[model samples]
Target chain A: MSDLLEARSVSRSFGGLHVTRDVNFKLTTGDRVALIGPNGAGKTTLVNLITGDIAPSEGQFFMGGDEITGLSIPDRVRRGLVRTFQTTRLFANLTVADNIALAIMQRKRITRRFFSSSTELPEVRAEWSEILSHLGLDRLAYRKVVELAYGQQRLIELAIGLALHPKVLLLDEPAAGVPHDEAPRILEAINRLPSDIAVLMIEHDMDLVFKFAKRVLVLAAGRLIFEGSPDQVTADHEVRRAYLGSYADARRPT
Target chain B: MSDIAVTHVPHKRNIPFAQEAAGALVILALGAIGWFLYPDDLAFLTRLIGIAFLVLSLDLVTGYCGVATLGHAAQFGVGAYAAGIACIRGVSDPVALLAVGLCAGTVMGLISGALITRFRGLPQLVLSIAVGQLIAGLANKLSWLTGGSDGLSGIEPGKVFGVFGFDMYSRTAFVFSLGVLVITFVVLQRFVRSPFGLMCRGIKDDDLRAKMIGVSIYPRLVVMYGVAGAVAGIGGALTAISTGVVGLDSVSFERSAEVLVMLVLGGAGHLWGALAGTVIFMIFEHIVAAANPFHWMTLVGLLLILIVVFAPRGLIEPVVLLWAKFKRKGSAV
Candidate 1:
C-alpha cells in the first residue's frame, strides 16, 4: 500500500550535533505504530519534522505523495497532518468546550466569521458534546482548562487533535505526566479512535505499546534500530541490548 | 451513559441584550452630561471622544491580539493627513473625509502590520516605534503636501448630511463625534463577540497552539490591525473636521505612548476599559494642569505608579470584579 505519510532520509542538525539522523520512515492509513526509544533517541524531533515545526537538514517530507517539506505548521494541519505536544499546550484561559470548538470551527472554515458565535449552532454543539462524552469530559466542559487536572488536560489535548479530523495523527507522549490511575483513560481513548485514521504515537510505557500498537519501531541515538511486531521487538538482541534490555528481563518467564 | 445525568451548565451563549442597552444608555447620558456641563468648552470634550476612539483602536491590536505595539499613532496621523489633504483638495463633505481617513489608516496598518508581525516580543515593539518615527519624519520632510511643522490647516468640514452646519459654538461637531462614537462602539461590540474575534483571542492566549489548530496567525493579525487602523483613522478625521487642523503631533511617538497609557489605565482587552481609561486619564490631566500646570506631570506620574501597584489590571478591572461578585451573591440568594 502507498504510504499516507513518508519521511525520506530525514536528518536534522543543530550546529555540530545531529539530533535526528537520515531516518527514513513511512506510515499508511489504519497503521497503528509505536515509536519507542530511550531518552535522547530523537523521537520528538522526528515528530516535529513531520509536523512541519522544524525543517530537516538534508531530506524531504510527503503527505500522500505530495511534497510538504516547505509548508508552515498550520498549512500542514490544513492538509490533515496533526500532532499533540509532549507537554500539554492549551488556551489556559478558555473553557474546555471553547478549545475544542475552536478546532472544529477552524476545520469547517467558519472561524473567520465576525458576527456569529460558533457554539450557537446546533450541529456544532452536538459534535462538541459527543466528543466531550466520548472522552468523559462532558462534566467539565464549561470549566477553564487551567482548572482541570493534569490527566484531564491531556485528554483535552487528545480531543483537540481528534477535532481536526486528521488523516495521520502523531501523538507525542500522550501519557507523559498523567497519573497512574488516570493513564487507562488515555489508553482507552486511543483504542477507541477510528482505525482509518493512521496513528503514530511516541511512548515510553511498554504496557501501552504492547496493548495498543500493532507495529513497533525502536530508535537509538537518532537512528531507527528496529521495526517489527511487538513480540519480535522484545526478542531482538540488538534492541534488547540497546534499549529494551531491562524490560525484556522483567518480562522473562521464570 | 443512561445512568449519568447530562446536567447542562449555563454558558455565555450570546451577547446579553440588557448589558448592551445599559451601555447605550450610558453613552447617551455621557453625551447629555457633557453638553450640560461644558457647553462653552465642548471642543475639549469632543477632542477627548476622538482620543477615546484612537485608544479603542489601539486596544484591538495591543490588548486583544497581544501585538505589543507602541506606534499606533502612525495610523492616526495617516488618517488625519488623509482627511486634511482631501479637505484641501475640496472634498468638504464630513462623511467623505471620514471615509478617506479610514482607507488611509487601513493601508498604513496593513503596511506596518506586515513588518511588525515578522518579529516577536521586543523586536516587535522596536519595529512599531521605528515605523511611527519613519512616518512622522516623512510628514515633516514632505512639507509641500503635508504642510510640514506649520501643521495642515483650512479643513472646513461642510455639514451633517447637508443639514446642520458645523457652527463656531462647537455644538454640531460635538454631536457628530458622539454619534460616530456610538456607532463605532456598537459595531465593535458585535465584532469582538464574533468568531474572528475569538480566533484573535486564541492567538493571544497561545499562539503556537492556535497555529497547531490550523489558524493562520499572521494573516489574522494583519486583518485585525487593518480594522484597528480604520477605527483610529475615523478618530483622526473627526479631529481634523472638528478642529479645522491636522498636526504632526497626531503621529508622534508621544501620542502613541499616551494612548497606550490610557488603554492600559482603563485596562486592556475589554472595550469599556478603553472608554474609561481615556476619560479618567484626560479628566485627571485637565484638572491637575488647571490646578498646578508645573507639577501636573509629577502628579500624573505618581497617580500611574499608584494604579500600577494597586490595580495592575487597570481601573475598570476592580469595578468589573466587584460587579461579578455582586451578581454571584444575588444569584445565590
Candidate 2:
C-alpha cells in the first residue's frame, strides 16, 4: 500500500547543535504510531518537518507522493496534514463550538460569507457537533475555552485538528499537563479517532503510549534508533541503552 | 504569555439576530433623542455621523482582526477627496458620490491593508501610520487636484432622490445621515456575526492555530480592511454631501488619532461601542468647547482618564457585563 505520509532522511541543525538527523519514516492508512524519546530527542522537530512548521536542513517530505517541502503551513493543512501544539493553543475567548466551527467553516469555504450568521449555520453546527460529541465535548459547545479544564482544552485541540479533515494528523503530546484521572478519557478520545487516517503522536507517558500505539518509533539524540511493535521496542537493547534503560531493565526477563 | 488575550473575542452568540435587533433599536432611539436635544446643532450631529463611520471602520481591523492601525485616516481622507472631486467635477448625485467615495476608500484600504497586514504589533502600527502619512502627503503635493492645505470646495450634492435640499439649518443633512448610519449599523450588525467576522476573530486570537486549521490570515485581514474602507469612504462622502466641501483636516493625523481615542474609549470590538464613543467624544467636544472653550479639553481628558481607569476594557465592557448579568439573572429569577 502507498504511504499516506513519508519523510526521507530528514535532518535539521542550529549552528553546531543538531536538532534532527537522518530521520526517515512512512505512515500508511490506519497506522497508529507513538513517537517517544527523552526531552530533546527532536521528536517535535520531526513532526514540525512533516507538518511544514520548520523546513528540513537536508531532507524532503511527501504527502501520499508529491513533495510538500515548499508548501506553506496552510497549504500543508489544506492537503490534510494537520498538527496539534504541545501546549494547548485554542481561541480562549471564544466558545467551544465557535472554535471547532471555525475549522468546519473554513473547510466548507463558507468563511468568506457576510450575510448568514456563522454560529446559526446548520451545516457548521452539524460538523462541530459530530466532532465534539465524538470526543465527548458536546457539553462544552457553549462554554468559552478559557473556562474549560486543561484536559477538555486538549480534547478541543484534537477536535480542531480533526475538524480540518486531516488524512495524516500530527499530535504533539496529546495528554501532557492533563490530570491522571482525566488522561484516560483523552486516551479514549485518541483511540476513538477515525480509524481510516494515519496518526503520529508525540508522547512521553509510556503507559499511554503503550496503550495507544499499535506500532512504536523510538528516537534518541536526533535520530530514530528503533521502529517496531511496542513489545519489541521495550526489548531492544540499543533503545534501552540510549533512553529507555530503566523501563527496559525493569521489564527484562532475568 | 500567561494572560495572553490575543484572541479575546468578547461577545457570545446564543439568540442569533435578537441581540443585533435590540442594539439597532437602541441606536435608533439614541439618534432620535440626539435630534430632539440638538435641534439647533444639526450640523454638529451630521459631523458626529461622519466620525462614527471612521470609528466603526477602525473596530473591524483593530478590534475584530487585532490589526493595530494608527493612520486609518488614509482611507477616510482619500475617500473624502474622491467624493469632493467627483462633486466638483460634476458627479452631483448623493448616491453616486457615496459610491465614488466607497470605491476610492476600498482601493486605499486594499493598498494599505495589503502592506500593513504583513507586519504585527508595533511594526504594523508604524506601517499604518506611514501609509496614512503617505496619502496625506500625496494629497498636499497634488495641490491642483486636492487644493493643497486650503481644502477641496464647491461640492454641491444633488440632494436625496433629488427631493430634499441641504438647507442652512442642516435638517435634511442630519436626517439623511441618520438614515444612512442606521442602515450601515443593521448591515454591520449582521456582518460582525457573519462567518468572515468569526474567522477573523479566530485569526486574531491565535493566528498560528488559525493557520493550522487551513486559514490564510493575510488575505482575510486585507479583505476586512477593504470592507472598512468602503464604510469610511461613505462617511467621507457624507461629509462632502452635508457640508458642501471637503478640507485637508478631513484626512488629518489629528482626525485619525481622535477616532482611535473615541473607539478605544467606547470599546474596540463591539459595533455599538464604536457609535457610542463617537457620539460621546464629539458631543462632549462640541458642548464643552462651546461652554468652557478654554478648559473643555481638561474636562474631556478627565472623563477619559476616569473611564480608562475604571473600565480598562472600555466603557462598553461594563455595560455588556451588566447586560449579560441581567440576562442571567432574568433567566434564573
Candidate 3:
C-alpha cells in the first residue's frame, strides 16, 4: 500500500547541535506506531518537521506522494496532517465545545463568515458532540478549557486534533502530565479512533506503548535504532539498553 | 458509528439579537435624552456621536483582536482629510462624503495594519504611535492643502440628500450623526457576533492555538484592522462634515490615546462598551470642563484611577454582572 506520509532522510540541526539526523520514516493507513526515546531523541522535532512547525535542515517530506516540504504549518494541516502539542496548546478562554467547533468550522471552510454563527449549524454541532463523546468530555463541553483539569485539557487537545478529520495524526506525548488513573481513558480514546487514520504517537510511558501501539519505532541520539512489533521492540537489546533501561526486563510479558 | 450518541445538544449561540437591540435602544435613548436635555448643544452632541464611532472602531482591533495599537487616529485623520478634501472640491452629498471616508479609512487600515501586524506587544504599540505622529506631522507640514496648524476649514456639506439644509441651530448635524451611529452600531453588532468575529476572539485569546487550527493569523488581523480603520474613518468624516473643519488634532497622538482611554473605560471586547465609554467620558469631560476648565483634567485622571482599580475590565463589567445576576434570579423562579 502507498504510504500516507513519508520523510526521506530528514535532518534538522540547531547550529552545532543536530536534533534530528538522517531520520527516515513512513506511515500507512491504520498504522498505530509508538515513538519512544530518551529526553533528546528528537521525537518531537521529527513530528514538527513532518507537521511543518519547523523546516528540515536537509531532506524532504511528502504527503500521499505530493512534495509538501515547502508548505506552512496551516497548509500542512489543510492537507490532513494534524498534530497535538506536548504543552496542551488550547484556546484557554473558549469553552471546550467552541474549541472543537473551531476546527469543524475551519474544515467546513466557513470560518470567514461575517453574518452567521457557525456553531448554530446542525452538522457542526453534531460533529463536536461526536468528538467530545468519543473522548468522554461531554460533561465538560460547556466549561472553559482553562478551568478543566490537565487530564481533561489533554483529551480536549486530542479532540481538537480529531475534529480536523486528519488522515495522519502526530500526537506529541498524548498522556504526558495526565494522572495515572486518567491515562487509560486517553488510551481508550486513541483506540476508538477510526482505523483508516494513521497515528504516530510520541510517548515515554512503557505500559501505554506496549498496550496501545501495535508497532513501535525507537529513537536514540537523533537516530532510529529499531522498528518492529511492540513485542520485538521490548526484546531488542539495543532498544532495551538505549531507551527501555531496567524497565525493559520488568515490562516483558511472560 | 454506533458508539456515537446523537443527543439533542442545544448549542450555546451568542444571542446577538436581544443584545444588539438593547444596545441600539440605549444609544437611541441617549440621543433622545441629549436632544431634550440640551436643545442648544446639538453641536456638542453631534461631536459626541462622532467620537463614539472612533471608540467603537478602536474596540474591534484593540479589544477583540488584541492588536496593541496607539496610532488608530491615523486612519481617523485620513478619513477626515479625505472628506474635507471632497467637500472643498464640491462633493457635498453626505452619503458621498461617508463613502469617501470609508474608502480612505479602509486603504489606510490596510497599509497601517500590514506594517503593525509584523510586530507584537510593545513594538506594535510604538509603531502605531509613531504612525499616528507621522500622519499628524504630515497634516501640519502640508499647510497649503490641509490648512496645516490653522486647521482645514470652509467645508460646507450642502444638505442631507439636498433636502434638509444645515441650520445654525445644528439640528441637522445631530440627526445625521445619530443616524450614522445607529447604522454603524447595528452593522458592527452583527459583525462581532459572526463566525469571523469568533475567529478574531480565538486569535486574541490564544494566537498559537489559532494557527494550529489552520487560521492564517496575520492576514485575518489585517482584514480586521482594515474594517476598524473604515469605521474610525466614518467618525472622522462625520466630524469634518458637522463641524466644517478638519484639524491636525484629528491625527494627533493625544487623540489616539484619548480614544484608547474611552474604549478601555467602557470595556474593550464588548461593542456596547465603546458607546458606553465614549458617552461617559465625553459627558464627564464636558460637565467638568464647564465647572472647572483648568482642573477638569485632574478629576478625569482620578476617575480613570478609580476605574482601573475598581473595574479593571471597564465600567461595563458591573452592568453585565448585574444583568447576569438578574437573569439568574428570573430563571430560578
lDDT of each: 0.89, 0.87, 0.88
Each model's Cα RMSD: 2.4, 4.7, 2.6
Rank order by lDDT, top first?
A: 1, 3, 2
RMSD of 1: 2.4
- Across B119-138, the per-residue lDDT of candidate 1 in tens digits comes to 88999999999999999998
lDDT of 3 by residue, B151-261 (tens): 999999988988998877789999899988988998898888677888898999988778778888899999999999999999999999999999888999888999999
The residue-by-residue lDDT of candidate 2 on A1-254, one tens digit each, is 67999989989998889999998999999999999888889898888788787898898889889999999999999999989999999988898999998988888889999979887587777677777767777766777899989999999998998888899999999999999999998888888888999999999898998898999999888989999999999988888888787987787788
The candidate, 1 or 3, that scores higher on DockQ is 3
- Clash totals in order: 0, 1, 0
**After superposition, candidate 3 runs with Cα above 4 Å error:** B1-5, B11-16, B322-333
TM-score on B-chain, cand. 3: 0.95
TM-score of each: 0.95, 0.95, 0.95
The alpha-carbon deviation from the true structure for residue A202 of candidate 3, after best TM-score superposition, in angstroms, is 1.1
| Residue ranges of candidate 1 with Cα displaced over 4 Å | B1-19, B322-333
